[model samples]
Target: MHRVRPLPNYLVQRYHGWKATGYADNKAWYRRLASDGQHPRAMVIACCDSRVNVISIFGADQGEFFIHRNIANLVPPFQPDGDHHGTSAAVEYAVQVLKVSNLMVLGHSGCGGIQGCIDMCKGHAPELEDKGSFVGRWMDILRPRFESVRDIADDKEQAREMEKQAVVTSLQNLMTFPWIEEKVNAGELTLHGLWNDIGEGSLENYSPESGAFHPV
Candidate 1:
């Protein structure tokens, strides 16, 4: 079956109309970026969920941010064994090449990947175990966290707290890179862990003092 793609006329017309706005002045400026290369101010590691697109969420102009999206918004520890890790590669380019000033790990509520990990940990998830599956291993990235926060709550409503902890874990993993750690210690780059709660259309900042996500 062929997929239905949005008509080119629709996209082209939208772009042409958007070019008239002051906010979209960069639309043409980005046309020059193909030859100039992208030099974004921030690098965002976000989730692959369709509703959680980082570019549209931040309302950033083209080439303004180097973004990487993966299941559950994960950033695995750096490894070198001839394995191609797309997320890590984007991180390297953003930090090493573009030299972005900020690195953000953005998480959202009601993430299917997070829920999958939660279900697997609770022994109720059966979908991933039957086939030649990598879900078990991929979800291992979140295993330690699930164990850490499972004792705090036993219901879906309380799982929001666990999601907050997972963001903290991702921040900790970010510093595993020597360059990132040095930059952070030297105040060259700032690391942020943010949670976007889709349910209430709210944004939360991870507060170290409270050990919870606080609305900004």
Candidate 2:
């Protein structure tokens, strides 16, 4: 509490406005959600990009989705090395405790994190090559996939291609968890990969059968 400070006036004012309008309009629903705890059916693992709005894009109400965001929306492989693993813990809670039926990895266009991975892999970004960089290590999860699109000469499109590959990698990584794999095998859970084009405001769903992404 000692480390905490009052919120900025702009954010405070916005909160008050939301309380007056949005909150007041849905007082009962909000109260119900609080009293009964969230039972979200889906868990959305999305990129920590300002452009990606997980709620607004789905037109989902509060408590509808248990959402987690990370750099490039990546999920590292299951490593129970006893170190703090925030993303894995969230995935465990969502799959084991919350029992979310659907999990989606949402990747977006022009993702800075994905671009950083590309640069680091190509020996372009010296800063990311440093071992002390947490972002550098995180982006390493996507490093192996970079080879798949290395032939693409266009830098922008190559980054976009790797952006979708991030989603593909995450989907594969989720199954590394024993519990998640068990649930998936039993048909209790489903995994999905998605890519978003921010400029076009379009969403594409990955089709494993066709090995392509199609607009929803």
Return the TM-score for each candidate structure: 0.83, 0.97
Worst 10 residues of 2 by lDDT: 155-164
Estimate the overall C-alpha local distance difference test score of candidate 1.
Answer: 0.79
Give lDDT tens digits, candidate 2, residues 8-38: 9999999999999999999999999999999
Clashing pairs in 1: none
Compared with the true structure, the alpha-carbon lDDT of candidate 2 equals: 0.94
Candidate 1 positional error at 84, Å: 2.3
Residue pairs in clash, model 2: none
> Which regions in candidate 1 have their CA more than 4 angstroms from the true location?
1-27, 129-131, 152-154
lDDT per residue (tens digit) for residues 93-168 in model 1? 8888889999998888888888887888888787754456666666667777876767765576547766676678
Please report how far candidate 2 places residue 80 from its true position, in Å: 0.7
